[model samples]
Target chain A: MIRLEQVSVFFGPTIALDGLDTTIEPGITGLFGPNGSGKSTLLRVVAGLLAPNAGRVTFEGSPVATSDEGFVRRVGYAGHSAGLYSRLTVRENLELFAVLHGRVRPDLEPLLEQIGLAEHSATRAGVLSAGLKQRAAVARALVHSPDVLLLDEPYANLDDEAAALVSCAIQEWWTPQRIALVATHGAKKLKAFAHGGLILKRGRTVVQGSYRERPEAETFS
Target chain B: MSGVGFVAKTAALTRKDLRVEARSRDTLPPMLAFAFTVALVLAFTLPDATRASAKVVAGFLWITVLFAGLIGFARTFEVEREEGALDALLLVPLDRSGIFFSKAAANLVFLALVEVFLVPVFGLFFSLDLSSWLMLALVVVLVDIGFVAVGTLFASLASQTRSRELILPILALPVLVPAFIAGVELSADLFAGAGLDDIAARGWFGILLFFDAVFLVVGALGFEFAID
Candidate 1:
């Protein structure tokens, strides 16, 4: 589980997140919002990827990544960018990720197959279609089998089938031992895996409730 | 500290980068050709320097390396940015400095390889005798390290821009002039059989070593901010 206490993030004059306090539990937690509503900021804070101008983010009741090395191993964050090696093959890219995380050999074929990129394994990631590229991005993110998965706009270009694979990967990856937070606009389809939802607007959470609860209160407040 | 992990991470980055370079053979071949062409053109244009001095050879080598290294450094982060792998790199547990150093190390190795052919060609054309090949190698290594350290840092910043590739050299060239000057002058002195101690002064080589250390630390310290 992750916790944030009165966290605020500023990009120069622009305030991305304002004095926000929230707890993110295990399972897929949808950080739902409109454009520039600070959904991404909140997820970054919980993942320890961004430091708050004020306040703090903690994991397992301790400061996340108290050391730089500690954080690198503990959190897996996927930003809005695709973040793949365009010139390298999908398998090579995954192998590199695995090696970075201390795995001697990563069985990426399984993840590649899961993401429907098995045939494209030898192809340069840059040459793949957008949906396939997104799938490859997911494969890289999960290659290390991280504890907490933070995905920003993960389903942007995916077709229905690809989206399902991504959704299932996130769902299957979520348990008491691991957590995933997804920041997205087209998150209605994520209702099934999301144990709860945190609706952010104008840099603060307007509502925090279960997936079955109405997001209307959060959107309006 | 995960120093070993940091090394592993750095090696992974270097290997992946080199692999990508290998895949895109066209990307590097043009630069090699361009470097040799510059040397050949200079050789044909000049009267055979029956009296070619070490100073002349030193200047020739530095200019060639600068132009050639600039092209290579500019392209260092291009593949990653285009492929969308930069974000994936930032997501890992490695320190930002580790990323910077790995990139620097990779660039250093590459530029050194190019210099291998470049130096001898410069020597052959200029009719200069490199009395101490070992000393010449040291200066080359140090100078290139300094150049690539700062160059790698600047490349990352430029990689995010609208005119990514074209902008890297413009930004990097101005910042690297001091290091380049030191490298060229020091190597010239050494080639001319100047006092080892005198060459150590701006010994362009020594200056380059100093700059290498400084930039390595600066690049390491500033990497987190740059990548984010």
Candidate 2:
């Protein structure tokens, strides 16, 4: 389990996460929050990308997410804006990231096929459609096979069929040993696929636990 | 997160950057064009006597490089800063210091290529001899190492700001002063007919060497904080 204790993140004078405390358990969990509700910030903190101003983020009861150790081997992340090198083909981007993650010559064909980008792997990320790019971004995150998969708005641009395919892929990859957190504003199928959910309002947990009850959280859950 | 040693990590980073540059053509072309244009303008604009003076000619060459480099330097981290690619880079497991060194290495590669075209044209326009081109290249490369070492650091830092193009020069130029001074001095002596040995005897070369070493180390260590 990942425990967040009084974590707060300040951007200049504005607060992004305000003394928030929560636990991210092992299993696929839906993260639902309205715009500017700190969904992305929370994922970043968990991924070890952004360091919180105060409090601790612990994984398995050990403090992390605030060091230069590249404390991210176990965590996979795809942010709100998909981060891919536009000039590179989807294949090259996946291969490059795999090398950086220290997995030499990784076999990415299966992951690419699973994400539904097997044929489009040769297409430059800049030229790919928004939905295709989103697919590629998902594949990029999974290339390292991280145990903790944290995807922010992975279904934003995907169509119904594509969303369903991605959801199925996510479900197939997630196991009890893994922690899967997908933040979404839409896509009910993906939300329904999640076992539980968390909600944030201006960076504080307004409600969390089984979110299938609330209609709004129902879609992202 | 297997341990890829320093050299392997640096090579991987550089390879990624070089492929992007080779395809996108975002950085090198503008820098080379600006360097040549400035040299041509100077060739026509300067009085014959001033152009003939070794120190003045050396100053013009160094100044042109410094200004033209600004164009390339501003865009060195363009790939990383765009979208959320920097976060992806930070996610990968490696010694973070390798990021800084790789950036410096990539910038050095671009600037050195610019000089390949730049020095010949500079020598021709300013009526300088190409006989000691080897010595001149050595001096320019030393300056290039120091320049890119500091330039890559400042560029990465400035890229985080709202107005990065304006911020890069402000952050980099001050720290680069001593190296620029040493570069011009060493090159001027070479153009003034001093051999490499003679220039070494004066000890200004030490300043260039030390400046390169100090900033290269500082840039690597301080880079983690700069990005954070």
Candidate 3:
């Protein structure tokens, strides 16, 4: 479980994320907010990409800053950027990342197939369609077999087929032992996969509860 | 052992970068050819190819490597930035300097490889002897290390901006001038039969070594800021 205690992220005078506090546990959690509402910033904080000005972000009982590498190893992060090489083929891209993360498992080929990228494995990432590229981006994240998945606007640019593939992967990939936090404005379609949701308005958590209780509250303020 | 892990990670990253460059095809060959062609042109222009001339200045050769090295360094992080691999690399638990050292090592290797072809061609053009050139090679290594040490980090930062490759050399060259001058002067003095024991040559050598050390430390210290 990841805990954010009174966390605040500031960029000069503009407060990106105000004094925020939350406990993100195992299971799928959605961060819904309008543009510039700090959903990405909060997710970046959780992924250990950004440092909060005050307060602490901890995984389990240890401080996040103290065990960056140890904590980073546990997270599969897909930022708003596709975070992929357009020049290299899908297989080359995935292989490079797997090596970078030090995951030498022989099952990478199978995992690529599992992600439905088996056919496009040899296709250069730049040449692939938008949906295929996004799917490949997610695959790179999971290559390390991270226990925690932090995705920012993952569904962006993906078509229905690609979206379904990603959604299915997220569902199949999630477990009580693992956690997934996805930031998106479109949470309605994800209700089938996500168990709960968290809403942020102007850098503050406006709501945190199950989707069934308050489906209307999922929208940004 | 942790430092060793850092070194291994650095080597792996360097290899990965070289592999990427290799697949791209045009990156290294053009640099090798460019270096040799520059040497050939300099050779033909000299009064006599076998005898030292005004064009045979050691400063000029070091200057050549600096410019050529910048070409390779600029391209070093270009593809990675475009592809977003840098973010993925950052996400790894490796110390940030692991990224710097690995890149420096790889740049050193690529630059060294180009120089392997370049130095011989340079010697051929200038009518310089290989026996004396061996000492000059150490200066080349020092100059190249210092050049890429900071160049790689700047490349990473500048590759993201609107200027693209145009900005890296602009930022790198001014800082590189001192090291280049020191290296070139030191090598010229050594090649001119001034004993390595000469105080001026030794001072210049010390300056080049010191510059290399500074870049190495500064590169490691400032890499996180640059990458971030």
Best by lDDT: 2
Output the worst ten-in-a-row residue range by lDDT, candidate 1 chain B. B199-208
Model 1 lDDT per residue over A90-192, tens place: 8888888788777775677777777788999998887888888887887777887888888887898998888998988787666677888888776666776
The regions of model 1 sitting more than 4 angstroms off are A10-15, A62-67, A212-221, B1-4, B25-27, B44-50, B130-132, B157-182, B189-211
* Residue B208 in model 3: lDDT: 75
Candidates, ranked, DockQ: 2, 1, 3
lDDT of 1: 0.78
Name the best candidate (by DockQ): 2
Model 3 / residue A220 / CA error / Å: 9.0
Looking at model 2 chain B, which ten-residue stretch has the lowest summed lDDT? B1-10
Show the colliding residue pairs in model 3.
Answer: A86-A126
Q: Write the per-residue lDDT of candidate 2 for residues A40-156, one digit (tens) a residue.
A: 899888887888999889888777653435457777889876789999999999988888878777788898888899999899998999999998888888888888898999888
Better of 1 and 2 by lDDT: 2
- The TM-score that candidate 1 achieves is 0.84
Native contacts conserved, per model: 0.66, 0.59, 0.39
With a 3 Å backbone cut-off (N, CA, C), the pairs that clash in candidate 1 are A72-B93, A83-B84, A83-B85, A84-B84, A84-B85, B182-B204, B199-B203
